[model samples]
Target: MWLTNARVFDATGAAARDGRAILIEDGLIAAEDQAGAVPDGVDVIDLAGRTVLPGLIDAHAHVFATPPTPDDGAEPLWPGLTAHFVATGLREALRMGFTTLRDVGSYGDEVITARQAMRYGAFPGPRLLTCGRIVSATAPGGRFFDGMYREADGPDEVRKAVREQVRRGADFVKVMSTGARSVELEDPHPAQLTGPEIAALVDEAHRLGYRVAAHAEGLAGTELAIRLGADTIEHGMYLNQRPDLLDEMAAAGQVLVPTLSCYYGVASGQWTAPLVRLARHNLAEASRTLLAARAAGVPIALGHDWQPFSDAAVELIRLVEHGMTTHEALLAATATGARALGLDDRLGTIQSGKVADLTVVDGDPLTDPVLLRDRAQIWLVLQRGAPVAGAVFDNSAAIAANARTAADSRSVTHTSALSNAGRPRSGTTETPG
Candidate 1:
């Protein structure tokens, strides 16, 4: 497939190229040429001034669970129902152009099952990397809801807990290293696990060949994770207190996945009152700290961290508004995220030999990142060279017919011949919406 005459943000540099053609063959970007030459009989898709970006990657999320809605009046559901909701959430994420995501602290092993199903072509979903459950302390505000976290006391139990997740085939280990806003804590700076306990957990996870992601919000917890060699730091909220720490993180090459969208939402009154109060104080600090970290060369990865999937775009906008350039934010949502998951060689950038997981926007994302948050602006979504959403197979008629239905509903009937829904391939042109 040859995608031609479009502005392409390859995610490897600050600028997008115009009038370039991306040659995709066997789910990989074969070449991106300015001459727009095509082999005989090759399918050429003219993008008509639209922009192509490497499919966005969300570094942290509970991909299997949906955020609570006001109209959701049903009683608590069983595990099966919860899994169903999770699948729905993952679909919404894919339609939003997140072709790759990390399920950090998925409530149970359901993500593992979901990952297997996606691999087997059960349904169209994003490429998922999952950490089965979070490891936390037994103290107050340490352990989260049952199924979401495992409570372990000392080093021995922390080590055991991490091993259990690895045994369950978890891609990584998520450890809660400090208190968060949702927990009932007097101050957020206290570390949940002692230094030795966290060290043991990190060691066990690394030995098992899995990266360790620390859920750190406070200064002490962030320092502990950094000192102990955690692979990624999730929400380093109190990073401003010690500017030197950002240098250490940058020097050590630890990726930071700060879910600024949560605080942004809270400050905007999307969350309830008590949480809003907490977020009001932390939001400014977090914003300043993020800028300092970026200036110090700390690699940032975009994560919604249980925020709605669309908030991933919002997070990128916030990063740009706070301090990062638009290209830096794009790199955070792509290259840095893939690097955090250890999949940079296969995904992330739109370079040759990388998977052709790409998102085509109806407008330039560099001018307005909000286009990513708007469903109508997403023209096409391709996962591994096959369309999973948007106007596939040149079917603007189908997309127009389903215009009233939201991309998040997971009810739009994808044309079998052009999608990854276990269908036959055919010659078709997918145009901008």
Candidate 2:
């Protein structure tokens, strides 16, 4: 297929170029140039005046979760309905221009099943990488959330739990380093896993070639996780309190997946007064810490921690509100996120030989980034060179059929060894290329 007449934003720290043409063959990008000529008999897709970018990635996601109700406490509200909830979230994310989703934690292998189904063409959705279940201690986590955790007691048990996830085909390991504040179920500031236990789990996961993601909110927990070498830190709310620690994180190249939308939801009055008062302090801390981290050179990636998949774009806006240019925020959702998930070489940027996945929005995000939060502005999405969702074309069903055929015929590897890079920046706009 030939895509033409669009402004192409490569998301590779390069300035945007106008009127470029891209060619896709066999689900991979074949070529791109300012005025490329197309071979005869190839299909043509005219993008009008829309802007093309690498498809967005959500580094921390939960495909099986729905919007939380304050009334629904610590357990699964609806039993045996996991598949339906997960499918709904995945479809909605794809329609909103996210082509890659990293599901950090879910109750079971539901995300694994979803990944295979999406790969084989059973449905239309983003590429999926999941950590089967979160490993936690039996004392605090197992007693409350039995369905979502594999509760174990010590270093030996934690190592075993990490192995259990790998045996279940988990792409990575997720451990709860500390309690959560939003749920009010456990101590929010104390470390749940001891240094030795965390070290044991990390050793096992890294030995098996999988990255580890830690749910760390407070200073004590975040410090322990960073010291133990976690690949990514989730909900780093207290990072501002220790700028020195932020510098350490920068030196170690640890990626931060701050889900600030969680706090914003509370401040926006999504919940009643009691919850609002409970969430305000933590929200303020998250806002301040995010700006500090950006200033300190920690790599940032966009991750919408829960439901209302459209809210994923809000993370980008929050980064800008804190202190980031629109181009930097765009790179967070695209290239930076891909790096965090270990899929950067294949999916992040719009260059030759990468998979042909692109998102075309109606307006220039560099000028008005909030437009990304509006689903109406997301005009088209192409996954692996197939038009899966859009205002112009809907070839998802056809793409699914092809995906199934491909999966059956070959063994495809979606997971990669974890790695990190130094801080990256974007280029200022100049004369159109």
Candidate 3:
């Protein structure tokens, strides 16, 4: 497939070009194959006024469905969550232009199932890396968080659980290292795992060929996760409040996923409305910490930690609002996100010979990050060089529609959920890629 008349923008940090084209062969970018650079015997697609870019990757997401009414103050438990529900939302994600996602948490192995389906062409979505269930000790997490967690007491139990998840076809493991904001469905506490336990999860994951993601949001937990070798920190909003630790994470080449929007959403009177004041203060501090880390040479990637709709692009804009140069925010979402997911080798850029996961935008995002926030200006998306407008394209509109429903008016009071209330669910916590 040849995509012509495209303007390519990617993390190479170069200027956006007009009339650029991409040649995709066998689901990989065979070459940049610029405008009028087509080879013999290939189909051509005249983009007509569109810009193309590497497919956008939302590196952190929960490919699980959410319950309609809060989880009745209980962590939403699941043993029956289906892959279809997740697949339902994935169609929307693709339409919204997100070609890939990382499932950071799920109540069960449904995320893994969803990933396999997409990989084998049984479903539609960007590429995925799924961390089975999350292992949370008694110190902090509560029951409402559901099957995603494995409550363990010692290193042995933690190690066993980590191995079990890998055996279940997990691409990675997730662990809860610290306490989180108080919410009804999720009872929050503090650093639930000790240093040894945290270390055990990471060590075992590495040995077993899986990366471990830590849900760390406190000083002790953050430091411990870093020390224990967590591959990524789910919501490092607290890192800004503790620069020393953030600096340490940077120095170690560790990645930080500041689901920066989730915290701010909490402040906006969504779920956990009463804590708005506290969330606000935390938001300011969180932004600063992330900025400091970026300045200090830390690899900061953008993760929505959001349901499909909350304007995922808004998550990137928030980074700019928090002091990241527009270029930095784009990198965080593009090159940085791919690196965080350990997919830098193929995805993240628009260079020749790279996978054709391009995201083309109208003005240079480096000049104005908000340009990315404007979905109307997104132009076109190429997943391995296939247009969103053609066959073999993942239907991402479904994800955007789902997100719109989430951001739209809800008949239920916000009291039933957490901050910035999340995605629509049919009793499961499934988010499309």
Candidate 4:
């Protein structure tokens, strides 16, 4: 397959190269050549100058996050129904041009099951990497988050928790070094786990050939994670308060997943006034930390940490809004994310001999990062050189023919439903896509 006449970003933090062509064979990028270099009889996809990019990646995601209702304190659906919701979220992420998602924390082994399901062709979805559950110090968060946390006390217990996740098929391990902001009974400041405990967990995970993602919100916890060599720091909002930590992270190659969208949701949601206030404060600190991290040369990755997975691209817009240039933000969502997930070699950039996962947008995202959040602007999403989801798959001709046939038969009801079904919905609204 050849994609011709395209403006390609390549996700190398460079300006788009216009009128280029990408050649794919056997699910790998064969070459990036001139538009006229295509051989005869090969499948040619004329992009008509559309912008092409490496498939987006979300480094920090929670695939099984189902916020509870305030009244009943229960999730909206049962476990069985929630699995279906999880599957739908994965498909939606793919439709939005995210070819890979790194789930930092999730309930039980559901993410593992979902990953296997996609691998087995039971469903169409993006590549998924998950930490089976968050390893947290024995705290109120365990009860608050239910099945999402694996609470342990001493260093030995935390090491056991890390081993448990590896046994359950986790790609990496997530450790809660600080209390969560969403849990009302817990504090978000101060290190929740002992230094020995964090060291043990990190050691165990690394010994097993896995990376560690540390949930770091406060200065103390963020510093500990940085010193302990956590591979990625999730929500290191308070890092701005400690320039030394930022320098350490930059030196250690620790990626920071700011997760600005998570705080935005908490501040905007109907939570307690104090929690909302804290979320607002954290949001401000996060903005400052993002700029500091960039200046310190620390790598930043895109992590939405919000619901309705399809709208994850909003993180790119938010990153740009919070002092990052559009080009830097694009790199955060692509190359940096792949680095965070340890898949940079094969998945991040549009290079020859790499897996051909790419997204084609109708507009240049470099000019307006918000174009990434617009579903209609997403023209084609290719996973391993196969068209998985996109507006290009709408088959408008067939839809119109069916509508005309219905109109000729005088079946107005059928024609109306068919026409309406083909129209795209706005925003993060769920669809069969």
Best by lDDT: 4
- lDDT against true structure, model 2: 0.77
Q: TM-scores across all candidates?
A: 0.88, 0.85, 0.81, 0.88
Compared with the true structure, what per-residue lDDT tens digits does model 3 show for residues 1-433?
6666766665777866777777677657776745764455555555545556667778788766754455556464465655666776676666456777787777666767777666666655666777777777854344767676778879999999898777777777888888666535342335668889998888988988777778877677878898878888877766766777777777777888877787777787875556888778778778778778887778888888755532677788888888887777777888888888877887888766777666656555556666666666664555655444211123334223222111223421212111122221122122223
Where model 4 places Cα greater than 4 Å from the true spot, the runs are 65-79, 396-433
lDDT of each: 0.78, 0.77, 0.68, 0.82
lDDT of 4 by residue, 1-433 (tens): 7677889989876678999989888778999866774454445566764799999999988896353366857645655766777888888898899988998877766788888778767667778888888999888999988888999999999999999988888889999999887886788688989899999999999998999999988778777888998999999998898999899999989999999988888899678888899889999999999999999999999999865687899888889989999999999988999999988888889999888889899888889778888888887787777667776556634323322222133322222111244433212211110
Reference-based TM-score, model 3: 0.81
Which parts of model 1 have CA positions greater than 4 angstroms off?
Answer: 67-73, 76-79, 141-143, 185-187, 270-272, 391-433
Clash count, predicted structure 4:
0
Each prediction's RMSD over C-alphas, in Å, is 6.8, 10.1, 10.8, 7.4
| Candidate 4 lDDT | 0.82
TM-score of 1: 0.88
Clashing pairs in 2: 120-403, 120-404, 121-400
Q: Give the C-alpha miss distance for residue 348 in model 2, angstroms.
A: 1.1
lDDT of 2 by residue, 63-121 (tens): 76564456756564576566766777887888788988889877666787777666656
Off by over 4 Å in 2: 65-81, 270-274, 394-433
lDDT of 1: 0.78
Tell me how candidate 3 scores on lDDT: 0.68
